[model samples]
Target: MTGCGRREPIVTIDGPAGAGKSSAARELARRLGFRLLDTGAMYRGLAWAVQQAGIPPEDGAPLRDLLERTTVELAGDRVLVNGRDVTAEIRTPAIGELTSVLTALDPVRDKLTPLQRALAAAGGVVLEGRDTGSVVCPDADVKFYLDADIETRARRRRGELAARGVDVGLDRVREEVLRRDRQDMARSLAPLVRPPGAVLVDSTSLGPEAVLRRLLEEVERVRCCTPP
Candidate 1:
């Protein structure tokens, strides 16, 4: 994935919740010297704004109105909505649930999809989200559908919450993970699917370093095959 005199490739990593897409995307971007686009954070930022404005989650009118006036910015690791920092605020289980629900809405996707594309327009970017490959960047140079066993994913989610000092039981976390998967797959608009031409990476037993190595290998393989 060297840039040199050619355009850098756009890489997309898409998968269900707790599949380690975020961590891998960040590290892969760092290793490749490309910008990391956390599309999930954009939705979370909107969810935080919706909560603050008391906008009903299922109500389209108010949500649309709020989105019309909203500005979600992903600056490094921080997420800002309407010029206010919300990176930490939107990471809770509650906000995550709300984000899943809000993302199923047409108004929300219509509002954010273009922003996501524009951000990756320059080509040197790694985008991670539920639909980054299937919907947001279907023509991305390299796309990966990273997944793990449900049990592994649930444990990962629980560990992440515990690290945040939010202590949650494994059973409860597992249920939440399952619920999110159902919602994501059942959504009418842009349901989570492994896009055409995407390489599937099962990371049930692989560590972060191993996953990064595999992703880098695939990227390099593509780079070699592509004409400059």
Candidate 2:
């Protein structure tokens, strides 16, 4: 479905919130032996730092200041925010809400997009985000626009949390997931969307393993078609 049909296999996995982009992309990267770049977690870490620095979520000026002083990096499964290790903190629901506000700023996106591009350009990176396929890495060798039923996505998220000892009501998680998707699609800066010729994978019926397998298979096919 990718029009660019580039020989390089970048593998941009873009989707709305709770579409399993993070977990799936991480695992897919591991299975494919590629570097995992969790773009959303980067933003989440920024939002967390923005809040921690006594900056109001709506204060673009303070948020801008935070990103400048903060050193955000992705090293395997570890996330470093402001030269500190806070990988576990960014996953909280509160950080996600703040992340939505932080990334909406043109200043923030302006700052982060370049970093994302450089990382993806480095090669064999599995990048995940709302706009990865559409804007961040439009020429990605294999662009996958992952999708799933809203209900399924919602339930799966909650289940994942429960497995980690965090209990969230299914109904609440469901509604929150839908709301976030709407927000992602509506954001003016690099909103979530499928790029032209991007392959669409609806994972409502497929588990993570099956979905990852199918993606790797497609990647192999895409690779084979390329002239060495």
Worst 10 residues of 1 by lDDT: 1-10
lDDT, candidate 1, 1-228, per-residue tens: 333223688999999988899999999999999999999999999999999999799757788889889999999999999888888889999999999999988889998999998998788899999999889988899999999999999999999888888999999999999999999999898998988989999999999999999999998787777776
lDDT by residue for model 2 over 1-228, one digit each (tens)? 333443457888988766778878988888878888888888888887887887787646766777778878887888998678888888877787788777778877887889998888766778988888888888888889899988888887887677767788999898888878777889888887888768898898988888888888888887788776
- TM-scores, one per candidate: 0.96, 0.92
After superposition, the stretches of candidate 2 with alpha carbons farther than 4 Å from their true spots are: 1-8
Q: Roughly what TM-score does model 1 have, to 2 decimal places?
A: 0.96
Q: Which runs of model 1 end up more than 4 angstroms from their true locations?
A: 1-6
